[model samples]
Target: MQTPRDFTELSMISKTRWQDEELQYFQHALSQILPYINSEGLTILHEINKEIYTRAEKQDSQYT
Candidate 1:
């Protein structure tokens, strides 16, 4: 699948529709490339993952 060239196109879709398998595939793909990516790419991934996990933790706490 082709990704949108514009960042705004990403906001048009809902991430809630993503399947666990698709998330796992992306995570695995990122892990494989982590070793080859430059520092800037690594920093970007780290920041994004940090936000994702932080939001997930907050959501989980709300259910408890």
Candidate 2:
């Protein structure tokens, strides 16, 4: 189970730039804790996923 502090940290982290490795770490962490989190956490998870997808799109565009 994740603590409220964990969610707070994640929320703060979500607002900043992330290296690919760090993003992957949090992505996995969030998925693992999904079943245990509240609706607010779910919202944060969606935000993280959106960030990941957005970054991927940017990287892909650079290669095109």
Candidate 3:
């Protein structure tokens, strides 16, 4: 299980700009910690997932 500090750091990161690779790295990290995280962490995870999906959709549209 991760500490609250871990979730806090991830939450901060989610609010900033993310490169594609960085987003993938954190996304995987969130998935690994999901089972052990609190409600706030879950909320951060959902926010990150939404960002990932939004970015993917934008990229796909550019190619279409």
Q: Tell me, by TM-score, which candidate is best.
A: 3
Better TM-score candidate (2, 3): 3
Give stretches of model 1 more than 4 Å off: 1-28
lDDT, candidate 1, 1-64, per-residue tens: 4432332442244434443344344455567899898996576456546555766899899999
* Count of backbone collisions within predicted model 1: 0
For lDDT, candidate 1 versus 3, the one ahead is: 3
Worst 10 residues of 3 by lDDT: 1-10
The residue pairs found clashing in candidate 2 are none
Superposing every Cα of model 3 onto the true structure, what RMSD results? 5.5
Q: For candidate 2, what is the lDDT?
A: 0.70
- Put down candidate 2 lDDT per residue, 1-64, tens digits, no spaces: 3223444455566444655665566678879999999998787778778888988899899999
Off by over 4 Å in 3: 1-10, 13-16
- lDDT per residue as tens, model 3, 1-64: 3222444454556444656665677678879988899997787778778888998899899999
Model 3 Cα shift for residue 7 (angstroms)? 7.8
Tell me each candidate's TM-score: 0.52, 0.70, 0.71
Count: clashes, candidate 2: 0
On a 0 to 100 scale, what is the lDDT of residue 5 in model 1?
A: 32
What overall lDDT goes with each candidate model? 0.55, 0.70, 0.71
